[model samples]
Target: MEQLFFILLALLTLSAALMVVTTRNLLHAAFWLILVFFGIAGFFILLHAEFLAVVQVLIYIGAISTLIIFAIMLTRRIMDPQQPRFNSQWGLVGGLAALLFVVLAAVTTRVAWPTTSATLPAEPIKQLGADFVGVYAVPFEVASVLLVVAMIGAIIIARERG
Candidate 1:
Protein backbone atom coordinates (compact mmCIF):
# COMPACT_ATOMS: atom_id res chain seq x y z
CA MET A 1 0.00 0.00 0.00
CA GLU A 2 2.76 2.41 0.93
CA GLN A 3 4.67 1.56 -2.22
CA LEU A 4 1.58 2.15 -4.32
CA PHE A 5 1.08 5.53 -2.64
CA PHE A 6 4.71 6.45 -3.21
CA ILE A 7 4.40 5.58 -6.91
CA LEU A 8 1.21 7.62 -7.25
CA LEU A 9 2.72 10.58 -5.46
CA ALA A 10 5.82 10.41 -7.66
CA LEU A 11 3.67 10.36 -10.80
CA LEU A 12 1.60 13.27 -9.55
CA THR A 13 4.68 15.32 -8.72
CA LEU A 14 6.35 14.62 -12.06
CA SER A 15 3.22 15.27 -14.14
CA ALA A 16 2.52 18.55 -12.38
CA ALA A 17 6.12 19.63 -12.81
CA LEU A 18 5.95 18.85 -16.53
CA MET A 19 2.71 20.80 -16.78
CA VAL A 20 4.33 23.77 -15.09
CA VAL A 21 7.27 23.74 -17.48
CA THR A 22 5.31 23.11 -20.69
CA THR A 23 2.24 25.31 -20.17
CA ARG A 24 2.23 28.49 -22.29
CA ASN A 25 -0.07 30.49 -20.02
CA LEU A 26 1.58 31.99 -16.94
CA LEU A 27 -1.57 31.55 -14.82
CA HIS A 28 -1.91 27.89 -15.80
CA ALA A 29 1.75 27.34 -15.00
CA ALA A 30 1.24 28.79 -11.52
CA PHE A 31 -1.70 26.44 -10.93
CA TRP A 32 0.37 23.48 -12.08
CA LEU A 33 3.13 24.56 -9.70
CA ILE A 34 0.60 24.48 -6.89
CA LEU A 35 -0.24 20.90 -7.82
CA VAL A 36 3.46 20.03 -7.79
CA PHE A 37 3.79 21.50 -4.31
CA PHE A 38 0.72 19.59 -3.15
CA GLY A 39 2.18 16.32 -4.43
CA ILE A 40 5.43 17.07 -2.62
CA ALA A 41 3.49 17.73 0.60
CA GLY A 42 1.78 14.37 0.13
CA PHE A 43 5.21 12.72 -0.24
CA PHE A 44 6.28 14.35 3.02
CA ILE A 45 3.21 12.93 4.73
CA LEU A 46 4.09 9.47 3.42
CA LEU A 47 7.50 9.86 5.01
CA HIS A 48 5.86 10.55 8.38
CA ALA A 49 6.77 14.23 8.28
CA GLU A 50 3.38 15.64 9.10
CA PHE A 51 4.68 19.03 10.15
CA LEU A 52 6.55 19.44 6.88
CA ALA A 53 3.48 18.41 4.93
CA VAL A 54 1.28 20.90 6.74
CA VAL A 55 3.83 23.70 6.42
CA GLN A 56 4.28 22.95 2.71
CA VAL A 57 0.54 23.20 2.16
CA LEU A 58 0.15 26.28 4.34
CA ILE A 59 3.13 28.23 3.03
CA TYR A 60 3.31 27.18 -0.61
CA ILE A 61 -0.30 26.47 -1.50
CA GLY A 62 -2.03 28.90 0.87
CA ALA A 63 0.28 31.93 0.83
CA ILE A 64 2.60 31.77 -2.18
CA SER A 65 0.06 30.40 -4.68
CA THR A 66 -2.55 32.93 -3.57
CA LEU A 67 -0.04 35.76 -3.92
CA ILE A 68 0.98 34.59 -7.41
CA ILE A 69 -2.60 34.26 -8.65
CA PHE A 70 -3.56 37.60 -7.11
CA ALA A 71 -0.65 39.30 -8.82
CA ILE A 72 -1.62 37.77 -12.16
CA MET A 73 -5.19 38.98 -11.75
CA LEU A 74 -3.99 42.47 -10.78
CA THR A 75 -2.11 42.87 -14.06
CA ARG A 76 -3.91 45.29 -16.43
CA ARG A 77 -2.92 43.64 -19.70
CA ILE A 78 -3.03 39.94 -18.81
CA MET A 79 -4.16 38.62 -22.17
CA ASP A 80 -1.32 40.22 -24.16
CA PRO A 81 -0.24 37.75 -26.86
CA GLN A 82 3.03 39.50 -27.57
CA GLN A 83 5.02 37.50 -25.02
CA PRO A 84 7.56 35.12 -26.53
CA ARG A 85 6.49 31.48 -26.22
CA PHE A 86 9.87 29.84 -25.64
CA ASN A 87 13.47 30.80 -25.11
CA SER A 88 15.86 30.35 -28.05
CA GLN A 89 18.26 28.38 -25.84
CA TRP A 90 15.62 25.91 -24.64
CA GLY A 91 16.97 22.98 -26.69
CA LEU A 92 20.48 23.39 -25.30
CA VAL A 93 19.16 23.75 -21.74
CA GLY A 94 16.92 20.70 -22.14
CA GLY A 95 19.77 18.53 -23.40
CA LEU A 96 22.04 19.60 -20.53
CA ALA A 97 19.25 19.06 -18.02
CA ALA A 98 18.67 15.52 -19.30
CA LEU A 99 22.37 14.73 -19.02
CA LEU A 100 22.52 16.09 -15.48
CA PHE A 101 19.45 14.11 -14.48
CA VAL A 102 21.01 10.90 -15.76
CA VAL A 103 24.22 11.56 -13.84
CA LEU A 104 22.32 12.35 -10.66
CA ALA A 105 20.19 9.23 -10.99
CA ALA A 106 23.30 7.06 -11.32
CA VAL A 107 24.87 8.69 -8.25
CA THR A 108 21.65 8.35 -6.25
CA THR A 109 21.39 4.65 -7.10
CA ARG A 110 24.95 4.13 -5.83
CA VAL A 111 24.24 5.63 -2.42
CA ALA A 112 23.59 3.28 0.51
CA TRP A 113 21.36 4.92 3.09
CA PRO A 114 21.94 4.29 6.76
CA THR A 115 19.64 1.78 8.44
CA THR A 116 17.71 2.61 11.61
CA SER A 117 15.95 0.29 14.04
CA ALA A 118 13.76 2.93 15.61
CA THR A 119 10.06 2.55 14.94
CA LEU A 120 7.94 5.40 13.64
CA PRO A 121 6.52 7.47 16.46
CA ALA A 122 2.96 8.63 16.97
CA GLU A 123 1.71 12.21 17.54
CA PRO A 124 4.07 13.67 14.95
CA ILE A 125 2.36 17.05 15.19
CA LYS A 126 3.15 17.36 18.91
CA GLN A 127 6.73 16.33 18.42
CA LEU A 128 7.15 18.75 15.54
CA GLY A 129 5.65 21.63 17.55
CA ALA A 130 7.92 20.93 20.51
CA ASP A 131 11.00 20.79 18.32
CA PHE A 132 10.04 23.91 16.40
CA VAL A 133 9.32 25.96 19.54
CA GLY A 134 12.35 24.67 21.41
CA VAL A 135 15.23 24.22 18.97
CA TYR A 136 13.96 26.08 15.89
CA ALA A 137 12.40 29.06 17.63
CA VAL A 138 14.85 31.65 16.27
CA PRO A 139 14.62 30.55 12.66
CA PHE A 140 10.83 30.28 12.89
CA GLU A 141 10.54 33.81 14.24
CA VAL A 142 12.89 35.08 11.53
CA ALA A 143 10.78 33.46 8.83
CA SER A 144 7.63 35.05 10.26
CA VAL A 145 9.33 38.46 10.22
CA LEU A 146 10.47 37.93 6.65
CA LEU A 147 6.97 36.97 5.57
CA VAL A 148 5.53 40.05 7.22
CA VAL A 149 8.04 42.25 5.44
CA ALA A 150 7.23 40.61 2.10
CA MET A 151 3.51 41.15 2.67
CA ILE A 152 4.15 44.81 3.44
CA GLY A 153 6.25 45.14 0.30
CA ALA A 154 3.52 43.58 -1.82
CA ILE A 155 0.93 45.95 -0.39
CA ILE A 156 3.15 48.93 -1.09
CA ILE A 157 3.70 47.78 -4.65
CA ALA A 158 -0.02 47.35 -5.25
CA ARG A 159 -1.02 50.65 -3.67
CA GLU A 160 -2.66 53.17 -6.03
CA ARG A 161 -1.31 56.71 -6.35
CA GLY A 162 -3.76 59.32 -5.10
Candidate 2:
Protein backbone atom coordinates (compact mmCIF):
# COMPACT_ATOMS: atom_id res chain seq x y z
CA MET A 1 0.00 0.00 0.00
CA GLU A 2 2.75 2.40 0.93
CA GLN A 3 4.70 1.55 -2.20
CA LEU A 4 1.61 2.12 -4.36
CA PHE A 5 1.01 5.44 -2.70
CA PHE A 6 4.59 6.46 -3.29
CA ILE A 7 4.37 5.56 -6.96
CA LEU A 8 1.18 7.58 -7.40
CA LEU A 9 2.70 10.57 -5.62
CA ALA A 10 5.83 10.36 -7.74
CA LEU A 11 3.74 10.26 -10.89
CA LEU A 12 1.77 13.29 -9.77
CA THR A 13 4.89 15.26 -8.99
CA LEU A 14 6.56 14.35 -12.26
CA SER A 15 3.49 15.22 -14.32
CA ALA A 16 3.02 18.51 -12.52
CA ALA A 17 6.67 19.40 -12.97
CA LEU A 18 6.45 18.62 -16.68
CA MET A 19 3.36 20.79 -16.94
CA VAL A 20 5.15 23.62 -15.17
CA VAL A 21 7.86 23.61 -17.83
CA THR A 22 5.63 22.98 -20.82
CA THR A 23 2.68 25.25 -20.10
CA ARG A 24 2.76 28.52 -22.01
CA ASN A 25 0.39 30.28 -19.64
CA LEU A 26 2.22 31.72 -16.62
CA LEU A 27 -0.73 31.29 -14.29
CA HIS A 28 -1.24 27.68 -15.33
CA ALA A 29 2.44 27.00 -14.81
CA ALA A 30 2.28 28.53 -11.34
CA PHE A 31 -0.68 26.30 -10.48
CA TRP A 32 1.23 23.26 -11.71
CA LEU A 33 4.22 24.30 -9.64
CA ILE A 34 2.01 24.45 -6.60
CA LEU A 35 0.93 20.86 -7.32
CA VAL A 36 4.57 19.91 -7.54
CA PHE A 37 5.20 21.49 -4.16
CA PHE A 38 2.29 19.61 -2.67
CA GLY A 39 3.71 16.38 -4.05
CA ILE A 40 7.04 17.12 -2.32
CA ALA A 41 5.22 17.69 0.97
CA GLY A 42 3.47 14.37 0.51
CA PHE A 43 6.85 12.68 0.03
CA PHE A 44 8.09 14.26 3.26
CA ILE A 45 5.05 12.89 5.03
CA LEU A 46 5.78 9.41 3.68
CA LEU A 47 9.28 9.67 5.15
CA HIS A 48 7.74 10.35 8.55
CA ALA A 49 9.14 13.86 8.61
CA GLU A 50 5.93 15.54 9.67
CA PHE A 51 7.57 18.83 10.55
CA LEU A 52 9.35 18.94 7.20
CA ALA A 53 6.11 18.15 5.42
CA VAL A 54 4.34 20.95 7.24
CA VAL A 55 7.13 23.35 6.49
CA GLN A 56 7.11 22.32 2.84
CA VAL A 57 3.40 22.97 2.56
CA LEU A 58 3.56 26.23 4.45
CA ILE A 59 6.70 27.69 2.87
CA TYR A 60 6.75 26.33 -0.64
CA ILE A 61 3.08 25.69 -1.43
CA GLY A 62 1.65 28.52 0.64
CA ALA A 63 4.10 31.39 0.66
CA ILE A 64 6.30 30.87 -2.39
CA SER A 65 3.50 29.70 -4.69
CA THR A 66 1.29 32.56 -3.62
CA LEU A 67 4.11 34.99 -4.32
CA ILE A 68 4.68 33.47 -7.77
CA ILE A 69 0.98 33.66 -8.64
CA PHE A 70 0.80 37.25 -7.47
CA ALA A 71 3.78 38.19 -9.60
CA ILE A 72 2.23 36.51 -12.59
CA MET A 73 -1.04 38.30 -11.95
CA LEU A 74 0.56 41.71 -11.57
CA THR A 75 2.49 41.41 -14.83
CA ARG A 76 -0.25 41.88 -17.42
CA ARG A 77 2.06 41.48 -20.37
CA ILE A 78 3.31 38.14 -19.11
CA MET A 79 -0.24 36.82 -19.10
CA ASP A 80 -0.85 37.93 -22.68
CA PRO A 81 -1.54 34.94 -24.91
CA GLN A 82 -0.18 36.76 -27.97
CA GLN A 83 3.23 37.23 -26.39
CA PRO A 84 6.02 35.02 -27.72
CA ARG A 85 6.52 32.16 -25.27
CA PHE A 86 10.03 31.16 -26.28
CA ASN A 87 13.03 33.41 -26.88
CA SER A 88 15.77 33.00 -29.51
CA GLN A 89 18.14 31.49 -26.92
CA TRP A 90 15.63 28.84 -25.87
CA GLY A 91 17.33 26.13 -27.92
CA LEU A 92 20.67 26.87 -26.35
CA VAL A 93 19.19 26.90 -22.87
CA GLY A 94 17.33 23.67 -23.51
CA GLY A 95 20.49 21.97 -24.73
CA LEU A 96 22.37 23.12 -21.67
CA ALA A 97 19.59 21.92 -19.39
CA ALA A 98 19.63 18.51 -21.08
CA LEU A 99 23.38 18.26 -20.67
CA LEU A 100 23.10 19.13 -17.00
CA PHE A 101 20.40 16.51 -16.53
CA VAL A 102 22.59 13.89 -18.19
CA VAL A 103 25.58 14.76 -16.02
CA LEU A 104 23.51 14.67 -12.83
CA ALA A 105 21.94 11.36 -13.79
CA ALA A 106 25.35 9.80 -14.47
CA VAL A 107 26.78 11.06 -11.20
CA THR A 108 23.80 9.92 -9.17
CA THR A 109 23.81 6.48 -10.76
CA ARG A 110 27.52 6.02 -10.07
CA VAL A 111 27.34 7.03 -6.44
CA ALA A 112 26.80 4.21 -3.95
CA TRP A 113 24.30 5.51 -1.44
CA PRO A 114 24.72 4.27 2.09
CA THR A 115 21.78 2.54 3.75
CA THR A 116 21.23 3.36 7.39
CA SER A 117 19.34 0.92 9.59
CA ALA A 118 19.28 3.24 12.56
CA THR A 119 15.96 4.05 14.13
CA LEU A 120 14.50 7.56 14.10
CA PRO A 121 14.49 9.71 17.24
CA ALA A 122 11.55 9.05 19.53
CA GLU A 123 10.73 12.74 19.85
CA PRO A 124 12.24 14.29 16.73
CA ILE A 125 9.72 17.16 16.51
CA LYS A 126 10.47 18.14 20.12
CA GLN A 127 14.20 17.96 19.48
CA LEU A 128 13.80 19.99 16.30
CA GLY A 129 11.75 22.64 18.11
CA ALA A 130 14.37 22.83 20.82
CA ASP A 131 17.19 23.12 18.29
CA PHE A 132 15.34 25.86 16.40
CA VAL A 133 15.05 27.91 19.57
CA GLY A 134 18.35 26.92 21.17
CA VAL A 135 20.98 26.48 18.44
CA TYR A 136 19.49 27.51 15.10
CA ALA A 137 17.49 30.41 16.45
CA VAL A 138 19.58 33.17 14.89
CA PRO A 139 19.76 31.66 11.40
CA PHE A 140 16.06 30.81 11.46
CA GLU A 141 15.14 34.33 12.47
CA VAL A 142 17.41 35.78 9.81
CA ALA A 143 15.75 33.68 7.12
CA SER A 144 12.33 34.87 8.26
CA VAL A 145 13.49 38.49 8.13
CA LEU A 146 14.92 37.96 4.67
CA LEU A 147 11.65 36.53 3.44
CA VAL A 148 9.75 39.44 4.94
CA VAL A 149 12.06 41.93 3.23
CA ALA A 150 11.70 40.17 -0.10
CA MET A 151 7.92 40.20 0.20
CA ILE A 152 7.92 43.91 1.03
CA GLY A 153 10.17 44.64 -1.94
CA ALA A 154 7.91 42.69 -4.24
CA ILE A 155 4.87 44.57 -2.99
CA ILE A 156 6.59 47.90 -3.47
CA ILE A 157 7.62 47.01 -7.00
CA ALA A 158 4.11 45.88 -7.89
CA ARG A 159 2.62 49.05 -6.42
CA GLU A 160 5.05 51.22 -8.37
CA ARG A 161 4.00 49.49 -11.58
CA GLY A 162 0.37 50.23 -10.77
Give per-model TM-scores.
Answer: 0.83, 0.85
What's model 1's lDDT at 119?
Answer: 90
The candidate 1 region of ten consecutive residues with least summed lDDT is 76-85
Pairs with backbone N, CA or C atoms under 3 Å apart (clashes), candidate 1? none
Error of 2 at 115 (Å): 2.7
- 136 Cα displacement, candidate 1 (Å): 1.4
Candidate 2 whole-model C-alpha lDDT, 0 to 1: 0.92
Candidate 2's C-alpha runs over 4 A off are 151-162
TM-score of model 2 (CA atoms): 0.85
Candidate 1 lDDT at 41 equals 96
lDDT of 2 at 56: 95
Best candidate, TM-score: 2
